[model samples]
Target: LRIRGGAVEAYDGAGGRRHWTHTRAGRRPLAVRPAPGHAFALWSDGLVTDTARTTGRTVHWHRAVPGLSRWLAAGGPGRAAGVLQALDRAARMLAVVTPQRIAAYRTRDGDLRWVLPAEPGCAFDARRTARTGGALLVAQPCGAGASWTAELVAVDDLGRIVPDRTPLRNGPPGDHARARKVVAGDR
Candidate 1:
Protein backbone atom coordinates (compact mmCIF):
# COMPACT_ATOMS: atom_id res chain seq x y z
CA LEU A 1 0.00 0.00 0.00
CA ARG A 2 1.28 3.46 -0.94
CA ILE A 3 1.21 5.21 2.45
CA ARG A 4 1.14 8.60 0.61
CA GLY A 5 1.04 10.01 4.14
CA GLY A 6 2.02 8.69 7.58
CA ALA A 7 -0.50 8.45 10.43
CA VAL A 8 -0.03 6.89 13.82
CA GLU A 9 -2.19 6.11 16.88
CA ALA A 10 -1.95 4.54 20.33
CA TYR A 11 -4.30 1.63 21.02
CA ASP A 12 -5.89 1.29 24.44
CA GLY A 13 -5.79 -2.28 25.74
CA ALA A 14 -9.45 -2.07 26.58
CA GLY A 15 -11.90 -3.46 24.07
CA GLY A 16 -13.64 -0.93 21.77
CA ARG A 17 -11.40 1.86 22.97
CA ARG A 18 -10.89 4.19 19.99
CA HIS A 19 -7.90 6.31 19.06
CA TRP A 20 -7.10 8.33 15.94
CA THR A 21 -4.04 10.19 14.69
CA HIS A 22 -3.63 12.72 11.89
CA THR A 23 -2.06 11.64 8.64
CA ARG A 24 -1.12 13.99 5.85
CA ALA A 25 -4.81 14.96 5.79
CA GLY A 26 -6.22 12.37 3.41
CA ARG A 27 -8.55 9.39 3.39
CA ARG A 28 -6.05 6.55 3.30
CA PRO A 29 -4.65 3.83 5.55
CA LEU A 30 -1.79 5.29 7.50
CA ALA A 31 1.10 3.14 8.70
CA VAL A 32 1.37 3.10 12.46
CA ARG A 33 3.79 1.62 14.99
CA PRO A 34 2.26 -0.96 17.30
CA ALA A 35 2.36 -0.79 21.13
CA PRO A 36 5.88 -1.86 22.06
CA GLY A 37 7.02 -5.24 20.83
CA HIS A 38 4.94 -5.96 17.74
CA ALA A 39 5.96 -7.90 14.68
CA PHE A 40 5.13 -7.41 11.00
CA ALA A 41 4.17 -10.03 8.47
CA LEU A 42 4.86 -9.34 4.81
CA TRP A 43 2.55 -10.98 2.30
CA SER A 44 0.96 -10.27 -1.06
CA ASP A 45 -2.25 -8.25 -1.21
CA GLY A 46 -2.86 -9.55 -4.75
CA LEU A 47 -2.88 -7.82 -8.12
CA VAL A 48 -4.56 -4.57 -9.08
CA THR A 49 -5.73 -2.75 -12.21
CA ASP A 50 -4.10 0.66 -12.36
CA THR A 51 -6.99 2.30 -14.17
CA ALA A 52 -7.47 4.84 -11.40
CA ARG A 53 -4.02 6.15 -10.58
CA THR A 54 -0.86 6.89 -12.55
CA THR A 55 -2.20 5.11 -15.64
CA GLY A 56 -5.72 4.46 -16.80
CA ARG A 57 -4.37 1.56 -18.80
CA THR A 58 -4.34 -0.54 -15.63
CA VAL A 59 -1.21 -2.05 -14.10
CA HIS A 60 0.07 -3.33 -10.77
CA TRP A 61 1.77 -1.10 -8.29
CA HIS A 62 3.07 -2.94 -5.20
CA ARG A 63 1.04 -6.09 -4.64
CA ALA A 64 2.22 -5.77 -1.03
CA VAL A 65 0.77 -3.43 1.54
CA PRO A 66 3.05 -2.14 4.24
CA GLY A 67 3.70 -4.97 6.68
CA LEU A 68 1.71 -4.63 9.95
CA SER A 69 3.51 -4.58 13.26
CA ARG A 70 1.90 -6.87 15.84
CA TRP A 71 2.77 -5.29 19.14
CA LEU A 72 4.36 -7.20 21.98
CA ALA A 73 2.18 -5.82 24.71
CA ALA A 74 1.73 -7.05 28.29
CA GLY A 75 -1.03 -9.56 27.55
CA GLY A 76 0.40 -11.40 24.57
CA PRO A 77 3.03 -10.29 22.18
CA GLY A 78 1.33 -9.79 18.80
CA ARG A 79 -1.94 -11.39 19.85
CA ALA A 80 -5.29 -10.58 21.41
CA ALA A 81 -6.00 -11.92 24.90
CA GLY A 82 -3.10 -14.24 24.16
CA VAL A 83 -5.36 -16.31 21.93
CA LEU A 84 -6.09 -16.59 18.21
CA GLN A 85 -8.75 -18.71 16.58
CA ALA A 86 -9.39 -19.16 12.90
CA LEU A 87 -13.16 -19.40 12.88
CA ASP A 88 -12.83 -20.33 16.55
CA ARG A 89 -11.04 -23.56 15.71
CA ALA A 90 -7.88 -22.80 17.65
CA ALA A 91 -5.90 -21.09 14.98
CA ARG A 92 -2.41 -22.56 14.68
CA MET A 93 -1.53 -19.21 13.32
CA LEU A 94 -3.31 -15.88 13.57
CA ALA A 95 -3.35 -13.36 10.75
CA VAL A 96 -4.25 -9.74 11.46
CA VAL A 97 -4.90 -8.07 8.11
CA THR A 98 -5.83 -4.51 8.97
CA PRO A 99 -2.22 -3.84 9.90
CA GLN A 100 -1.03 -6.99 8.15
CA ARG A 101 0.67 -9.06 10.85
CA ILE A 102 0.93 -12.87 11.18
CA ALA A 103 1.68 -14.86 14.32
CA ALA A 104 1.88 -18.55 15.11
CA TYR A 105 0.79 -20.12 18.42
CA ARG A 106 0.48 -23.25 20.57
CA THR A 107 -1.79 -22.96 23.61
CA ARG A 108 -1.26 -26.02 25.82
CA ASP A 109 2.44 -25.45 26.36
CA GLY A 110 2.93 -21.79 25.62
CA ASP A 111 4.84 -22.80 22.52
CA LEU A 112 5.24 -19.85 20.21
CA ARG A 113 5.27 -20.11 16.46
CA TRP A 114 6.23 -17.29 14.21
CA VAL A 115 5.72 -17.53 10.45
CA LEU A 116 7.11 -14.36 9.07
CA PRO A 117 6.69 -14.03 5.30
CA ALA A 118 9.85 -13.29 3.43
CA GLU A 119 7.86 -11.94 0.54
CA PRO A 120 5.79 -8.91 1.46
CA GLY A 121 1.99 -8.65 1.12
CA CYS A 122 1.36 -12.08 -0.33
CA ALA A 123 -1.50 -12.78 2.10
CA PHE A 124 -4.78 -11.00 2.87
CA ASP A 125 -7.85 -11.57 5.11
CA ALA A 126 -10.92 -13.09 3.50
CA ARG A 127 -14.53 -11.95 3.66
CA ARG A 128 -15.52 -15.28 5.21
CA THR A 129 -13.91 -18.21 7.00
CA ALA A 130 -15.00 -21.81 7.25
CA ARG A 131 -13.58 -25.22 8.01
CA THR A 132 -14.05 -28.32 5.91
CA GLY A 133 -11.96 -31.50 5.99
CA GLY A 134 -9.80 -30.02 8.72
CA ALA A 135 -8.86 -27.09 6.54
CA LEU A 136 -9.28 -23.40 7.24
CA LEU A 137 -10.89 -21.78 4.22
CA VAL A 138 -10.51 -18.03 4.18
CA ALA A 139 -11.63 -15.51 1.58
CA GLN A 140 -8.62 -13.43 0.58
CA PRO A 141 -8.01 -10.41 -1.61
CA CYS A 142 -6.82 -11.32 -5.07
CA GLY A 143 -6.79 -9.13 -8.21
CA ALA A 144 -7.81 -5.49 -8.10
CA GLY A 145 -9.18 -2.75 -10.33
CA ALA A 146 -11.15 0.21 -9.05
CA SER A 147 -12.17 -2.15 -6.24
CA TRP A 148 -10.64 -4.27 -3.48
CA THR A 149 -10.54 -7.75 -5.00
CA ALA A 150 -10.44 -11.00 -2.99
CA GLU A 151 -10.49 -14.80 -3.21
CA LEU A 152 -10.69 -17.97 -1.14
CA VAL A 153 -7.62 -19.31 0.66
CA ALA A 154 -7.56 -22.79 2.14
CA VAL A 155 -4.92 -23.67 4.70
CA ASP A 156 -4.58 -27.35 5.20
CA ASP A 157 -3.83 -29.05 8.52
CA LEU A 158 -0.23 -28.36 7.68
CA GLY A 159 -1.08 -24.69 7.46
CA ARG A 160 -0.62 -24.25 3.77
CA ILE A 161 -2.90 -23.25 0.92
CA VAL A 162 -4.16 -26.07 -1.29
CA PRO A 163 -5.25 -24.55 -4.59
CA ASP A 164 -3.34 -21.67 -3.02
CA ARG A 165 -5.54 -18.90 -4.43
CA THR A 166 -8.97 -18.43 -5.99
CA PRO A 167 -10.99 -15.38 -7.02
CA LEU A 168 -13.71 -13.89 -4.80
CA ARG A 169 -13.91 -10.17 -5.31
CA ASN A 170 -15.28 -8.19 -2.29
CA GLY A 171 -15.09 -4.68 -3.67
CA PRO A 172 -12.65 -1.81 -4.29
CA PRO A 173 -10.15 0.22 -2.24
CA GLY A 174 -11.84 3.44 -3.35
CA ASP A 175 -9.60 6.25 -2.07
CA HIS A 176 -8.45 4.56 1.14
CA ALA A 177 -5.61 2.09 0.91
CA ARG A 178 -6.43 -1.24 2.54
CA ALA A 179 -6.05 -1.25 6.35
CA ARG A 180 -2.94 -2.96 7.70
CA LYS A 181 -5.07 -4.75 10.28
CA VAL A 182 -8.11 -6.86 9.33
CA VAL A 183 -10.70 -8.04 11.81
CA ALA A 184 -9.30 -11.35 13.17
CA GLY A 185 -11.11 -14.65 12.65
CA ASP A 186 -13.34 -15.88 9.84
CA ARG A 187 -15.75 -13.28 8.48
Candidate 2:
Protein backbone atom coordinates (compact mmCIF):
# COMPACT_ATOMS: atom_id res chain seq x y z
CA LEU A 1 0.00 0.00 0.00
CA ARG A 2 1.08 3.60 -0.73
CA ILE A 3 -0.26 7.10 -0.45
CA ARG A 4 -0.65 9.04 -3.67
CA GLY A 5 -2.67 12.12 -4.48
CA GLY A 6 -3.91 12.20 -0.88
CA ALA A 7 -5.35 8.66 -1.14
CA VAL A 8 -4.12 5.31 0.09
CA GLU A 9 -3.91 2.82 -2.78
CA ALA A 10 -3.61 -0.94 -2.61
CA TYR A 11 -2.15 -3.09 -5.34
CA ASP A 12 -2.31 -6.75 -6.27
CA GLY A 13 0.43 -9.33 -6.75
CA ALA A 14 0.58 -8.59 -10.44
CA GLY A 15 1.14 -4.89 -9.74
CA GLY A 16 -2.43 -4.11 -10.67
CA ARG A 17 -4.27 -1.45 -8.77
CA ARG A 18 -6.80 -2.94 -6.41
CA HIS A 19 -8.46 -0.21 -4.40
CA TRP A 20 -7.93 3.32 -3.17
CA THR A 21 -9.20 4.79 0.09
CA HIS A 22 -9.39 8.54 0.33
CA THR A 23 -8.00 10.16 3.44
CA ARG A 24 -10.66 11.61 5.70
CA ALA A 25 -10.87 15.37 6.35
CA GLY A 26 -7.79 16.16 4.25
CA ARG A 27 -5.38 14.16 6.41
CA ARG A 28 -2.93 12.19 4.32
CA PRO A 29 -2.32 8.54 5.16
CA LEU A 30 0.48 8.30 7.70
CA ALA A 31 1.53 4.70 7.24
CA VAL A 32 0.44 1.60 5.37
CA ARG A 33 1.00 -2.03 6.31
CA PRO A 34 0.70 -4.50 3.44
CA ALA A 35 0.12 -8.02 4.68
CA PRO A 36 0.36 -11.34 2.96
CA GLY A 37 -2.17 -12.26 0.24
CA HIS A 38 -2.83 -8.67 -0.79
CA ALA A 39 -4.54 -7.65 2.43
CA PHE A 40 -3.25 -4.48 4.10
CA ALA A 41 -3.65 -2.14 7.08
CA LEU A 42 -3.54 1.64 6.93
CA TRP A 43 -2.98 4.15 9.71
CA SER A 44 -4.34 7.63 9.52
CA ASP A 45 -5.50 10.19 12.04
CA GLY A 46 -5.25 7.84 15.04
CA LEU A 47 -7.10 4.99 13.33
CA VAL A 48 -6.08 1.66 11.90
CA THR A 49 -7.97 0.54 8.80
CA ASP A 50 -7.90 -3.11 7.83
CA THR A 51 -8.64 -4.20 4.26
CA ALA A 52 -9.70 -7.55 2.93
CA ARG A 53 -7.41 -9.30 0.47
CA THR A 54 -9.93 -11.05 -1.71
CA THR A 55 -12.56 -8.34 -1.81
CA GLY A 56 -10.39 -5.23 -1.73
CA ARG A 57 -12.72 -3.64 0.78
CA THR A 58 -12.25 -2.34 4.28
CA VAL A 59 -13.07 -4.87 6.96
CA HIS A 60 -12.78 -2.73 10.06
CA TRP A 61 -11.04 0.15 11.83
CA HIS A 62 -9.30 0.40 15.19
CA ARG A 63 -8.54 3.51 17.22
CA ALA A 64 -4.92 4.35 17.99
CA VAL A 65 -3.11 7.41 19.35
CA PRO A 66 -3.57 10.67 17.57
CA GLY A 67 -0.76 12.78 16.01
CA LEU A 68 0.96 9.89 14.25
CA SER A 69 0.25 11.42 10.88
CA ARG A 70 1.95 14.64 11.79
CA TRP A 71 4.79 12.91 13.57
CA LEU A 72 5.57 10.62 10.66
CA ALA A 73 5.19 13.41 8.15
CA ALA A 74 8.03 15.21 9.90
CA GLY A 75 10.14 12.00 9.85
CA GLY A 76 9.90 11.62 13.60
CA PRO A 77 11.24 8.03 13.29
CA GLY A 78 9.09 4.93 13.90
CA ARG A 79 7.38 3.07 11.12
CA ALA A 80 3.67 2.44 10.91
CA ALA A 81 2.68 -0.98 12.15
CA GLY A 82 2.19 -3.91 9.77
CA VAL A 83 2.51 -7.67 9.24
CA LEU A 84 5.94 -9.31 9.26
CA GLN A 85 6.53 -12.90 8.21
CA ALA A 86 8.87 -15.13 10.12
CA LEU A 87 10.43 -17.48 7.64
CA ASP A 88 11.67 -19.90 10.27
CA ARG A 89 8.33 -20.15 12.01
CA ALA A 90 6.30 -20.09 8.82
CA ALA A 91 3.91 -17.56 10.30
CA ARG A 92 3.05 -13.89 9.96
CA MET A 93 2.78 -11.43 12.83
CA LEU A 94 1.51 -7.91 13.24
CA ALA A 95 3.89 -5.25 14.58
CA VAL A 96 2.59 -1.97 15.96
CA VAL A 97 3.87 0.81 18.18
CA THR A 98 2.63 3.08 20.92
CA PRO A 99 4.37 6.28 21.85
CA GLN A 100 6.47 4.50 24.43
CA ARG A 101 6.62 0.91 23.20
CA ILE A 102 6.40 -1.57 20.37
CA ALA A 103 4.16 -4.64 20.26
CA ALA A 104 3.64 -7.69 18.14
CA TYR A 105 0.38 -9.45 17.29
CA ARG A 106 -0.51 -12.73 15.66
CA THR A 107 -1.85 -12.05 12.21
CA ARG A 108 -4.09 -15.07 12.00
CA ASP A 109 -6.18 -13.92 14.98
CA GLY A 110 -4.78 -10.53 16.06
CA ASP A 111 -3.40 -11.96 19.29
CA LEU A 112 -0.93 -9.91 21.30
CA ARG A 113 2.29 -11.71 21.99
CA TRP A 114 4.82 -9.19 23.25
CA VAL A 115 5.66 -5.57 23.88
CA LEU A 116 8.97 -3.77 24.41
CA PRO A 117 9.68 -0.29 25.68
CA ALA A 118 11.22 2.00 23.08
CA GLU A 119 13.73 4.75 23.60
CA PRO A 120 12.06 7.85 24.93
CA GLY A 121 11.47 10.62 22.36
CA CYS A 122 12.76 8.49 19.55
CA ALA A 123 11.07 6.86 16.56
CA PHE A 124 11.48 3.17 15.81
CA ASP A 125 11.57 2.09 12.20
CA ALA A 126 11.91 -1.59 11.32
CA ARG A 127 13.46 -3.02 8.18
CA ARG A 128 15.11 -6.22 6.99
CA THR A 129 18.87 -6.37 7.33
CA ALA A 130 21.34 -9.03 6.24
CA ARG A 131 23.07 -8.84 9.61
CA THR A 132 19.99 -10.00 11.56
CA GLY A 133 19.24 -13.37 9.90
CA GLY A 134 15.81 -12.09 8.81
CA ALA A 135 14.86 -10.53 12.12
CA LEU A 136 13.50 -7.02 12.13
CA LEU A 137 16.10 -4.23 12.42
CA VAL A 138 14.94 -1.21 14.37
CA ALA A 139 16.70 2.13 14.00
CA GLN A 140 16.19 5.16 16.21
CA PRO A 141 17.51 8.52 15.01
CA CYS A 142 18.51 10.87 17.77
CA GLY A 143 20.55 13.98 18.61
CA ALA A 144 21.16 16.93 16.38
CA GLY A 145 23.87 19.04 14.67
CA ALA A 146 27.37 17.70 15.25
CA SER A 147 26.21 15.44 18.04
CA TRP A 148 23.70 13.45 15.96
CA THR A 149 23.36 9.78 16.78
CA ALA A 150 21.27 6.73 15.91
CA GLU A 151 20.64 3.62 17.92
CA LEU A 152 20.07 0.20 16.40
CA VAL A 153 18.07 -2.66 17.84
CA ALA A 154 17.03 -6.03 16.51
CA VAL A 155 13.83 -7.86 17.30
CA ASP A 156 13.61 -11.57 16.68
CA ASP A 157 10.59 -13.59 15.61
CA LEU A 158 9.35 -14.10 19.16
CA GLY A 159 9.19 -10.37 19.91
CA ARG A 160 12.36 -10.21 21.93
CA ILE A 161 15.08 -7.67 21.23
CA VAL A 162 18.30 -9.34 20.18
CA PRO A 163 21.17 -8.35 22.43
CA ASP A 164 24.76 -7.20 21.86
CA ARG A 165 24.41 -5.81 18.37
CA THR A 166 26.54 -2.69 18.15
CA PRO A 167 24.87 0.58 17.31
CA LEU A 168 26.02 2.39 14.16
CA ARG A 169 28.31 5.37 14.44
CA ASN A 170 29.29 7.97 11.94
CA GLY A 171 32.66 7.28 10.44
CA PRO A 172 35.35 9.93 9.84
CA PRO A 173 35.12 12.00 6.70
CA GLY A 174 36.37 10.34 3.45
CA ASP A 175 35.12 6.90 4.57
CA HIS A 176 32.49 6.91 1.87
CA ALA A 177 35.01 7.97 -0.75
CA ARG A 178 37.36 5.14 0.23
CA ALA A 179 34.54 2.61 0.26
CA ARG A 180 33.40 3.75 -3.15
CA LYS A 181 36.88 3.33 -4.55
CA VAL A 182 37.13 -0.16 -3.14
CA VAL A 183 33.77 -1.08 -4.62
CA ALA A 184 34.71 0.40 -7.97
CA GLY A 185 37.97 -1.55 -8.07
CA ASP A 186 36.13 -4.83 -7.40
CA ARG A 187 34.29 -4.36 -10.68
Candidate 3:
Protein backbone atom coordinates (compact mmCIF):
# COMPACT_ATOMS: atom_id res chain seq x y z
CA LEU A 1 0.00 0.00 0.00
CA ARG A 2 1.12 3.56 -0.70
CA ILE A 3 -0.07 6.98 0.40
CA ARG A 4 -0.63 9.66 -2.20
CA GLY A 5 -2.08 13.08 -1.36
CA GLY A 6 -4.82 12.18 1.17
CA ALA A 7 -5.38 8.60 0.02
CA VAL A 8 -3.85 5.20 0.61
CA GLU A 9 -3.80 3.00 -2.45
CA ALA A 10 -3.41 -0.74 -2.61
CA TYR A 11 -2.31 -2.01 -5.95
CA ASP A 12 -1.48 -5.37 -7.49
CA GLY A 13 2.27 -5.83 -7.17
CA ALA A 14 2.53 -7.88 -10.33
CA GLY A 15 0.27 -6.00 -12.73
CA GLY A 16 0.09 -2.60 -10.98
CA ARG A 17 -3.70 -2.85 -10.96
CA ARG A 18 -5.35 -0.73 -8.26
CA HIS A 19 -7.32 -2.80 -5.80
CA TRP A 20 -8.47 -0.30 -3.17
CA THR A 21 -7.99 3.24 -1.99
CA HIS A 22 -8.85 5.03 1.24
CA THR A 23 -8.75 8.73 1.89
CA ARG A 24 -9.35 11.20 4.70
CA ALA A 25 -10.97 14.57 4.37
CA GLY A 26 -8.91 17.69 5.19
CA ARG A 27 -5.81 15.67 6.08
CA ARG A 28 -2.53 15.35 4.25
CA PRO A 29 -0.56 12.14 4.12
CA LEU A 30 2.86 12.17 5.79
CA ALA A 31 4.19 8.63 5.82
CA VAL A 32 3.30 4.99 5.45
CA ARG A 33 5.43 2.46 7.24
CA PRO A 34 5.24 -1.33 6.92
CA ALA A 35 3.95 -3.44 9.79
CA PRO A 36 3.99 -7.18 10.13
CA GLY A 37 1.84 -7.96 7.10
CA HIS A 38 0.07 -4.67 7.74
CA ALA A 39 0.59 -0.97 6.97
CA PHE A 40 0.69 1.97 9.35
CA ALA A 41 0.16 5.45 7.96
CA LEU A 42 0.71 8.81 9.59
CA TRP A 43 -0.76 12.18 8.76
CA SER A 44 0.81 15.61 9.06
CA ASP A 45 -1.48 16.46 11.95
CA GLY A 46 -0.65 13.43 14.10
CA LEU A 47 -3.36 11.17 12.76
CA VAL A 48 -2.64 7.49 12.25
CA THR A 49 -4.19 4.99 9.91
CA ASP A 50 -3.86 1.28 10.40
CA THR A 51 -4.56 -0.55 7.17
CA ALA A 52 -4.90 -4.28 7.01
CA ARG A 53 -2.95 -5.84 4.18
CA THR A 54 -5.53 -8.47 3.38
CA THR A 55 -8.80 -6.53 3.52
CA GLY A 56 -7.59 -3.03 2.64
CA ARG A 57 -9.76 -1.74 5.49
CA THR A 58 -8.48 1.04 7.75
CA VAL A 59 -8.75 2.29 11.33
CA HIS A 60 -8.03 5.88 12.23
CA TRP A 61 -6.47 7.14 15.45
CA HIS A 62 -5.97 10.82 15.94
CA ARG A 63 -2.99 11.28 18.20
CA ALA A 64 -4.15 14.74 19.24
CA VAL A 65 -7.01 13.03 21.06
CA PRO A 66 -8.36 11.03 23.94
CA GLY A 67 -6.51 12.53 26.99
CA LEU A 68 -4.18 14.78 25.06
CA SER A 69 -6.55 17.67 25.14
CA ARG A 70 -6.32 17.70 28.92
CA TRP A 71 -2.58 17.75 28.77
CA LEU A 72 -2.60 20.52 26.25
CA ALA A 73 -5.08 22.50 28.31
CA ALA A 74 -3.09 22.11 31.49
CA GLY A 75 0.04 23.29 29.79
CA GLY A 76 -1.71 26.08 27.96
CA PRO A 77 -0.51 27.33 24.59
CA GLY A 78 2.98 26.84 23.04
CA ARG A 79 3.38 23.36 24.45
CA ALA A 80 3.74 20.61 21.93
CA ALA A 81 1.41 17.70 22.52
CA GLY A 82 0.45 14.49 20.76
CA VAL A 83 3.93 13.87 19.44
CA LEU A 84 4.48 10.21 18.64
CA GLN A 85 7.70 8.82 20.03
CA ALA A 86 7.76 5.19 19.04
CA LEU A 87 5.78 2.36 17.55
CA ASP A 88 6.50 -1.16 18.80
CA ARG A 89 5.00 -3.68 16.43
CA ALA A 90 6.20 -6.62 18.50
CA ALA A 91 4.54 -5.27 21.65
CA ARG A 92 1.65 -3.89 19.62
CA MET A 93 1.98 -0.63 21.49
CA LEU A 94 2.36 2.98 20.36
CA ALA A 95 4.27 5.26 22.69
CA VAL A 96 3.16 8.86 22.61
CA VAL A 97 5.35 11.30 24.50
CA THR A 98 4.78 14.85 25.59
CA PRO A 99 6.74 17.19 27.81
CA GLN A 100 4.87 16.03 30.89
CA ARG A 101 3.94 12.40 30.22
CA ILE A 102 4.33 9.30 28.12
CA ALA A 103 1.33 7.27 27.08
CA ALA A 104 0.97 3.81 25.62
CA TYR A 105 -1.75 2.76 23.23
CA ARG A 106 -2.73 -0.45 21.52
CA THR A 107 -1.50 -0.28 17.93
CA ARG A 108 -4.22 -2.56 16.55
CA ASP A 109 -7.21 -0.65 17.93
CA GLY A 110 -5.78 2.61 19.30
CA ASP A 111 -6.92 1.79 22.82
CA LEU A 112 -5.30 3.73 25.61
CA ARG A 113 -3.29 1.38 27.77
CA TRP A 114 -1.36 3.41 30.31
CA VAL A 115 0.14 6.80 30.96
CA LEU A 116 3.41 7.47 32.77
CA PRO A 117 4.01 10.90 34.12
CA ALA A 118 7.44 12.36 33.76
CA GLU A 119 9.57 12.57 36.84
CA PRO A 120 9.90 15.98 38.42
CA GLY A 121 12.54 18.04 36.64
CA CYS A 122 13.12 15.29 34.09
CA ALA A 123 11.63 14.03 30.85
CA PHE A 124 11.74 10.73 29.01
CA ASP A 125 13.85 10.08 25.93
CA ALA A 126 11.63 7.97 23.76
CA ARG A 127 14.37 7.12 21.28
CA ARG A 128 16.16 5.45 24.15
CA THR A 129 13.57 2.73 24.41
CA ALA A 130 13.89 -1.03 24.19
CA ARG A 131 11.64 -4.06 24.34
CA THR A 132 12.64 -7.26 26.04
CA GLY A 133 10.85 -10.22 27.64
CA GLY A 134 7.41 -8.66 27.38
CA ALA A 135 8.58 -5.41 28.90
CA LEU A 136 9.26 -2.01 27.39
CA LEU A 137 12.27 -0.17 28.78
CA VAL A 138 12.51 3.59 28.56
CA ALA A 139 15.35 5.87 29.50
CA GLN A 140 15.05 9.09 31.46
CA PRO A 141 17.91 11.42 32.21
CA CYS A 142 18.33 11.94 35.91
CA GLY A 143 19.79 14.96 37.73
CA ALA A 144 19.53 18.65 36.88
CA GLY A 145 22.43 20.75 35.74
CA ALA A 146 25.09 20.11 33.15
CA SER A 147 25.60 16.41 33.76
CA TRP A 148 22.88 13.76 33.51
CA THR A 149 22.68 10.03 33.97
CA ALA A 150 20.32 7.60 32.33
CA GLU A 151 17.64 6.01 34.46
CA LEU A 152 15.99 2.94 33.07
CA VAL A 153 12.30 2.24 33.59
CA ALA A 154 10.71 -1.10 32.84
CA VAL A 155 7.02 -1.32 32.04
CA ASP A 156 5.52 -4.77 31.73
CA ASP A 157 3.08 -5.85 29.06
CA LEU A 158 0.18 -5.14 31.36
CA GLY A 159 1.35 -1.50 31.65
CA ARG A 160 2.56 -1.99 35.19
CA ILE A 161 5.90 -0.65 36.32
CA VAL A 162 8.28 -3.47 37.20
CA PRO A 163 10.37 -2.02 40.01
CA ASP A 164 12.48 -4.96 41.00
CA ARG A 165 13.21 -6.02 37.45
CA THR A 166 14.33 -2.59 36.39
CA PRO A 167 17.72 -2.58 34.83
CA LEU A 168 20.83 -0.70 35.92
CA ARG A 169 21.30 3.03 35.38
CA ASN A 170 22.74 4.32 32.08
CA GLY A 171 21.49 1.21 30.32
CA PRO A 172 20.38 -2.39 30.78
CA PRO A 173 22.41 -4.75 32.94
CA GLY A 174 25.46 -6.61 31.62
CA ASP A 175 25.85 -4.42 28.52
CA HIS A 176 25.85 -0.74 29.32
CA ALA A 177 27.89 0.21 26.28
CA ARG A 178 25.55 -1.56 23.92
CA ALA A 179 22.56 0.17 25.38
CA ARG A 180 24.32 3.48 25.15
CA LYS A 181 25.03 2.77 21.52
CA VAL A 182 21.37 2.15 20.89
CA VAL A 183 20.42 5.31 22.71
CA ALA A 184 22.95 7.16 20.61
CA GLY A 185 21.27 5.92 17.43
CA ASP A 186 24.27 3.87 16.46
CA ARG A 187 22.26 0.77 15.67
- Give the Cα-based TM-score of candidate 3 against the true structure: 0.53
lDDT of 2 by residue, 22-123 (tens): 455656555665555433344455555555545555554343534555554555434543322332243355556544556665445454556667666665
Task: Give residue 71's error in model 3 in angstroms.
Answer: 12
TM-score quality measure for candidate 2: 0.55
Model 3 lDDT-worst window of ten: 177-186
List candidate 2 stretches off by more than 4 Å: 12-27, 58-70, 73-91, 97-99, 120-131, 141-150, 162-187
Off by over 4 Å in 1: 1-83, 86-101, 114-123, 145-150, 162-187
- lDDT, candidates in the order shown: 0.31, 0.49, 0.57
For candidate 3, lDDT tens digit of each residue in 1-187?
7777678777788999887777778765555655555565655455556667656765545455444445444543334322443344453666665555677666656667677787777766654667685556767776656244336666643444543333222222353451221122236
Pairs clashing in candidate 2? 78-124
> 1-187, model 1: which lDDT tens digit per residue?
1222332233345673434332323333322212112211121121111111221222222223233322222222222221223322433223333324333332222223334332244344432456786565555454453233235555532334434333222113242332222224457
Q: Candidate order by TM-score, highest to lowest?
A: 2, 3, 1
